[model samples]
Target: MEDTNHKQSKFQRVLDFIERFGNKLPHPFLIFVYLAAIIIIISAIVASFDISVTHPGTGEEVVAKSLLSGEGLLFALETMLENFTGFAPLGLVLTMMLGIGVAQGVGLFDTAIKLTIEKAPRAVITYAIAFVAVMGNIASDAAAVIVPPLAAMVFYSLGRHPVAGIAAGFAGAVGGFTANLLIAGTDALLAGITTEAARAIDQDMLITPIDNYFFMATSVFLIVLLVGLVTEKVIEPRLGKYDPKYAEEGILAQKQEKVGRIEIKALRNSMIAALVYIGVILALIWPETSVLRGEGGVLVPSPFLSNIVPIIFVFFIVVSVTYGISAKTIKKSGDIPVFMASAVKDMAPYIVLVFAIAQFIAYFNWTNLSTIIAVNSADYLQSVNFVGLPLIIIFILVMGMLNQFITSGSAQWALMAPVFVPMFMLLDFHPAFTQLAYRIGDSSTALLTPLNPYLIMVLGFMKRYDKRSGLGSIISTMIPYTIALMVGWILLMIVWFLLDLPIGPGINIRLDG
Candidate 1:
């Protein structure tokens, strides 16, 4: 007991230092503004040096375009408003909250939680939550917004630490984001970029979104086990026991009505409505003649997949409204608009943060520094002649470290793929293999990065439990999972390399192309 207390005290000091350091920095919005300004200055300096890379596809010279130039300045002024509006997460979050807010306001989520916990075995609840969070990647942005709070409610109902629940959910939703049992929106997005990069070298190279499906599916189990172990053994224990006496006012005193006949009926009706919505979706896409199908009768690049965000919004709204009416929590249609207004109101801070982040991303792209770094780094790696498993391991490490600053998986890949994918193909490695390696690195350290919007979003969730919780607390809690995932993923890559395993459907470790 004494030793444990001593260790915890030391850890607390470290957390305190981290919190102070992070707190000393500007707000997330201001940080982005500063980054944008820095990019402009750096762009002008780099552009003067006459640095450029040859586009492998067209042999065109890709030069760094300085944001300080007249054309660049005009572009920035023209696109400033468009950048914020065009930012993907902004719309996704706003629309999702509209649907989720109705359910949340009507107390459907609470009743549902009570029902789920009453039947689920305590021993596997942690694993189950983590698994569902991992699978929620199929819904894109929906998982990030919905899972953490739901998990926290579950833990609170079970007399466990809410922070631990949110942490586990965060780990699954964001940390294990790259690995899923089903093909996710990210898969299609990255695969398209990879194809563009690969075609730069070999026009005949073909890659599908499912290029890493087998490996990613296998990895879901590993993530579940690893996250479950960390949550139960490390996080929960560190949090110690949950005491109702010390919990927030009304948090425990607000008596939850046990799942009764009325609540049960509401749940049943909501589930049926949800099933119907799903059926309608399936009916739309079941035949090649369906409008949802993309060109050549394929699902990839389909309208259905591209429009999944709105589908999620509609699904949640329909189910929640059904439950609210059945449960008598919603007495009128006016209540829904109220819920939507409240939901967006809660997202005010996020809106402010997104504006600055959007500008920063746009400025970075305008500067072309990311592309230059990726190309130069890949060329340097090639010049070193590092090959085989060692090269694979180092590549993962470098990518993982870079993830701390560049949190966008597709953006990072867009920069690196044109260089690494073709270079790897020249080394007799397959594009799919290289893509998988990049995915592994991109995901392993995502939760540790402050630049990740989801991490910031989860911090807001965490504060509901501990008012003092900050970026440091969240990052410290997640460090174990990040390290474990990185090491485990790297080892998996090594095993795949040694066994000469196919990473996906007919995709081997190396290809002649």
Candidate 2:
């Protein structure tokens, strides 16, 4: 029996090792979409199973709900179709990526990286690396698109392990993406759901992107510290000894576009235009009679203040116009539509995927089965009357463990929220606080998982520098960061909970009334 167990462990290790290598050979997005398809099928099957649990609210035992039933499947299809037609982030992403794509296509991103490498103080590399990782999300592709290769080049240039550089950059990009300081797809989705939950208690919960700014801004530093320590102290050291062969080959990373004279002019114009736009916006919002506010005053409750969405629209428009004019993409105003059209074209596939995803999410919720199970599960726990803080900690750990399987934070939140939000609410915890907890849990595991499509891409890049690199290599490298991050991050949440700090504006872990 002992021999058999040992052999099984050895075989498992070999399989993981192979999977790591296999991962390097596949494209990140391809693997993501592929696995997404698998997850969809598996989740659908999981949903289809007639597993049962008692209802939390009523303490009544119940059977698992069936999506196969009439009305269930119909509801699913209808919801998914709706997602395809309206409210998909596809359009927003398309528009944003156009500006980003053009910027990259024109060579500014590479220039930006070169500037960082040239000027960034060596003492601050960790934060600089992490900061670039954070801001890269502005393009949403810069991290995967730019960071790894750039890191490899920088490391090789500086006489450090190129794999360490790639690993750190890869981790920062994907992992940091999970938490953004402002409006993003995750924020939008979470906010929409938050509005839903808040309405249950108070019809008006105008939670905005900056709703949790206070905590999140602070979280940025905490994460940077955590990532920096893990990367510098652990990841880099373990990766040791720069491969001189890599140096001999002189395999420096490539830049797509050079910020030549044309791009420089475009960049200048764009910056100037962005500032001008901000000045006008600030002038309007800063004063009482500027007419940017609501009905109470010229600057009060007015459409200008409420029109944040259009501002988001105008921001892209203004920047795109400036960049295009300077770069000669737009000779006249008429050229603007062409750029916009191109942007929209890129989003069509993402739109399809989202449409499918949204349907799965909405359909699962409508069935009431997920909520029922969550409630019952919470009830069972409550019946035992376990320690509150411990239970929360345990929940966080469970969320971390599950993150290895489910990589999409928003999708996972969509499913988990409908369950935990209501269940935690019953336990006197506010939905926002619970949502925040879910974010931390989801993020810490993202870097270490094979299921993360981006991780596969990162692995592939790692192997480029070291042919022997594979899945086990990626996981082994990332595990230290993951373990370190999990410990510190969970502790931060614990302190926050104990201190009774507001998770966000008017949002608490426990509800009053």
Candidate 3:
């Protein structure tokens, strides 16, 4: 027992050190503020030194345009509002959430979750929770906030370690972040950045928002299996039997309620409505002369791929409203606007973060620093005879480390895409492949990061089961998932690469092929 306690203590000390370092960093919004200021200062210094690079596609000389200059300062002043409002992630995330908000506001998601949890077989409950948690990303903010606590309740009712359920939910939701059956705002956000970066290398290059859809859809199954195994075989067993002593506090101690008829009806109606909506979409895209397909029946560069977020928005709002009406949750038409407004209101923090991030990205592009770094990095890799698999492993590791300090997917990709995407393209890698590697890395460390906002909620769920649970406890439970996911996902990517499988329709690992 003493040896066991000592090993646990040592593991805890590592988490403590990680949390301490992470706490020293500013809020993500402020981090962007600091980054923007630093970029401007560095750009001025570099401009003074006359550093420049030749554009890879255009063959035009590019030089840093210091924000300290009068014209540069004026441009910043004039474009500040535009930067915030025109930011790609800002509008896309908001648009999708507006629809999702209606579904959540009307008790649609709550009913659906209850039905799923209660009806799942005892042996498969862990997989069910993990799978639902991963799919919940389609609803944006609601999933991260709603799933963990509910998962704890379900586990406690089943006489299992509730904390293990919380960990499972978190592992699938945040750690399996990029793996989803449906494309969400983050997909569109990252693809937009990838497109911008690829254009810098090849003027006519275009990347679809769902460029990684095939790979990610397959990943959802893997996340469910792997995370479910970890929860049942590793975490739950380690936790042993749950004590009633610990259960007498927080949410777990509250009275449990059965799923009502109204909720069941709501869920049933929602499913029917969702299928009809999907059928409509399929009917529109099935024919060779369908308007949804681009020229020559191509999927990529098609209107359907480009308009995915809006399509998701329409689906969520319409079906959720139908469910609300059937469930008697919505009595008046005015309720629809209220729910939509609630969703937008919930995104206040993201708006501020996007504002700062937009300024940083615009300034980075103006200064040409990212291009210069991409050229230099590509040159160094070439000199070392590095390309293909070894380079991919390095990119994944670098991104995994960075995820610890920067938890926002869009923000991290905003910083990385400008340099790494083009650099990989120079190595004959397609931008889709580069984005795929980055996504795998960014997701792998999400469960272990103190910087992740969702981890705070996960810790809260843990405390409901064990009042003294801390950041260290949560991190310790999650580190195994983080490591396992990185290795497993990377190996998957390697096999996919070796097999020369297309990551998406008309997209491959190599640009020229």
Candidate 4:
């Protein structure tokens, strides 16, 4: 027992160190501010060296330009406002959030989550929680807040370990964050950043939100299976039987609110509205003579794809408003704007962070630093002959490690996409493929990070059942899921690579091919 206690103490010390380090880091907003200043200084230093690289696509000599130079200062002063307003992700995220905000405000997301798990068979309860949690990401961060507590209630009612349910829900909500069956705000946000980055190499390149649709859609099932398996087979068994004595007073007596008839009616009406919306879209794009079709009637890169964000916005408005009216959440048309405004209000922090990131990316591009770094990095990789699956895996691993400290996927990608997307493009890999790889890495370690706010939230929920629960207890329980997901996702990527399958509509794995 002494030896076991000693080993556990050492493990706890390591976790404590990681938490301290992560906590010492500044907010993501401040990090970007610091990065913007550092890049300005670095650009001046590199420009003084007169170093340059030949752009692989255009064969043009790209030299680093100093932000301190007169021309650079003028450009920065002139483009500061344009950089923030014209940041691709700014409008995309806000537009999608408007619709999502309505859906959440109307209780559509909460009702759907309850209906999914409350109706599940006892045998598949674990799987249901995992599935709903993974799919719930379509509702955005609200899922992270809503799923775990409800899942724990469901688990406790069924005589299972409530902490196990929390783990499953958190694992699916965060660890499987990037894998969803439908195109979500994350798709638009990430694609916008990727498009901005890819333009560093191919100025005309535009990455659509659906660029990784096929891969992400397929990954949903894999994540659900892995999360369910880890929860039932490993986590539950390790947790053993739940003892009510460990639970806080009155906690066990508290019951989850059952889905009422009004919610069910609202969900049904919303589904009908969603189906009608989709049917109208299909009718508009189904015919060769349809206006939504491309120049040659191609669906990909067509009017339908180009206008996907608007379509998503309108669809959400229609369905959510329908549900809101049916559920009495919206008494008047004026209430719609109120909900939309509230959503944007929640995005205030994101808006501020985007301002910082936009300036950083704009400065990086103006200085030609992105192109210079990408070209030389691509050259070095080629020199070492690291140009295939091995290189892709290494990149994914690097992203996973970075995610430990930088928990925000968009922030990390915004920082990384500028450099890595173009480098891979030079290596003849598609920007979509690089983005897909980044998602795999970014998501696989999400639950393992001490910096993840949702992880701490889950820890708090766990302590209600076992007051002794701490960060170490939650982290240790999550380790199995994290390892299984990372390995499983990497293997899935290997298969996708070997198959050379189209990741999305008309998006290939390799650029030249």
- Which candidate has the top score in TM-score? 4
**Can you write out model 1's per-residue Cα lDDT over 419-500, one digit (the tens) per residue?**
6787776567888889999998998888887667788899887876777777778988999999888888888778877888
Which segments of candidate 2 are over 4 A away from where they belong? 1-114, 193-207, 246-269, 287-307, 327-343, 360-381, 386-388, 505-510
TM values, all candidates: 0.67, 0.75, 0.92, 0.98
Best lDDT among the predictions, by candidate number? 4
Compose the digit string of candidate 3's lDDT tens values, residues 1-513.
Answer: 999999989977766777778889788788878988998899999999999988776789988778899978997999999877876667777787788889889988777766777789998999999888888876665567777777888888888888988888888888777878877767777776787677667757767667898888888888888899889888988888887676534565664467898778778888898999999999999897888899999766688877777888899887889988988888999999999898888888877777888888778777788788888888888999988899899899999998877778887887788778888887889998899999999988888877677888778778777887888788889988887888889988999989988887778888887
lDDT accuracy of residue 363 in candidate 1:
72
Model 3's TM-score against the true structure: 0.92
1 against 3, candidate with superior lDDT? 3
- Which of the two candidates, 2 or 3, achieves a greater lDDT against the reference? 3
Off by over 4 Å in 4: 1-7
In candidate 1, the residue pairs with backbone N, CA or C atoms under 3 Å apart (3 or more residues apart, or in different chains) clash, namely none
User: How much is 231 displaced in model 2, in angstroms?
Assistant: 2.4
Going through the candidates in the order shown, the clash numbers are 0, 15, 0, 0
